[model samples]
Target: MTTLHLEHASHAHIHGPACGHTQVPHGDHVDYAHDGHLHREHGGHWDECEPDGHAPHEGHDHRHGEGCGHESVLHGDHVDYLHDGHRHAPHDGHWDDH
Candidate 1:
C-alpha cells in the first residue's frame, strides 16, 4: 500500500493510498494555483496536491463504505452508488451539465 503526503497551508503529511486521490468538493472550478502548491477543495475541505516526487496512476478509485451502501468516485468515468446489490447512477443534480 503506497502512501501520499499532502502538504497544505494549515496542515501537512496526510497519508493515503497512491491511487486514491480525492478533491474536496468545493462547488466548481478548482483552483490549482494557491500558495505555490497544488490545491483542491471538496465538500468545504482543502487539500494539497501530490508533488512531482509522487507517482501518477492512470486510474484512481476512492470509495468508502457507509452502512449497507457504498459510495465511490471514479476518475475519467461517471460516479456510481451501489446499495443493497443495486447500482445507481448519480442524479442529474450531481453534474453541472445536466
Candidate 2:
C-alpha cells in the first residue's frame, strides 16, 4: 500500500445502497466505486479511499487472471479480481485483499 492524500468530493451527494454505485466493504467502512476511484463518506462529505497496508488473503491457492471466471477491476496500478464480495489483487507470490 502507498500513502495517499485523500481529497474531498466537489458535489454534495450521499453514497449508500441506493446511490447506484458498487459498494465495497473496506475495513470498518464501505467504499463506493465512482468515476474510476473509491469514495468513502466522512463528516458529511466524501473522501478518496485507499488501502493503508498489505492485507494478504491467506490460503488463497487460486490465481486470478485471464479467464479466471471473475470480474476484474482496474485498480490504481494493478488489476483486482472480484470474488465472493471481496477484491483480490496479485502480489508477492500470493493474493492481497485490496
Candidate 3:
C-alpha cells in the first residue's frame, strides 16, 4: 500500500462509474485504469496504485509468457497478463490475480 508521489493526474479529473475508465478493486481502495497503469485518488491528486502481495488465482492452467495471447500490463517490476477481464501475474508456481 503505497502512493506514487511523483505520478499523479490532474486534480480536475474526477474518476467514477461514468468516468469511462475501468474501475478495479484494489484491497480496500478502487483504482482506475488509465493508459497502462492504475490510479487512485489521494488527497487532491491521483496516485499510481501498486498493490503488494499476490492473491492466487485458482484453476489457472494456461501459462502466460511472451506469446500467451493476453494483453500484457507492466505492473511495477513485473508484467501481468489480462485474462477474461482480470489481470494475472506469475507467482511462485501459479498465476496470481494482480
Candidate 4:
C-alpha cells in the first residue's frame, strides 16, 4: 500500500492503493467549495504496481522522473503558499520576505 498525503492551506488530498481506494482528505470542505468557490484541482493516480507487472514492495524507484506517475501541484492565479516542513506568514501578493 502506498500512501501519499497532499496538503494546501485547509485543503488536503490523500491517495493510496491499500483497499483500491483514492479519497480526498478535504472531506466536507470539498463539497462546500464545489460551487466554484475554489479552483478545480487535478492529480495523478498512484498504484502499487511496478513496471514489471509485479507488486512494488521493494527495489522500486519512486523518483520524480518521466513515467513515474508522480503528482505535482500547479499554481495558477492564486498565490501558492506552501507551508510544508516550514512556517510561513500570509503576505499579500508576495511569497518572498524582503
TM-score of each: 0.25, 0.71, 0.57, 0.16
What lDDT is obtained when candidate 1 is compared to the true structure? 0.36
Tens-digit lDDT string for candidate 2 (1-98): 54255866485777889998778777677878777767888777788887778889999999899998987766777777778777898988999887
Among all windows of 10 consecutive residues in model 4, the one with the lowest summed lDDT is 27-36
RMSD of each: 13.8, 3.1, 4.5, 16.5
Q: Say which candidate scores most in lDDT.
A: 2
What is the C-alpha lDDT profile of model 3 across 60-95, one tens digit per residue?
999999998976766666777778766787878999
* Model 3 pairs whose backbones collide: none
Could you give candidate 1's per-residue lDDT for residues 32-80 as a string of tens digits? 3233333554444556543233232222233333452454433235543
lDDT (Cα, tens digit) per residue for candidate 4, span 10-77 = 44444333422322223221211121122224344222221122232233223332353432222233
Better of 1 and 3 by lDDT: 3
Please give the lDDT score for candidate 3.
0.74
Off by over 4 Å in 1: 1-31, 51-98
> CA shift at 37, candidate 3, in angstroms?
5.0
Clashes of 2: 0
Q: Which stretches of candidate 4 lie over 4 Å from their true place?
A: 1-27, 31-61, 76-98
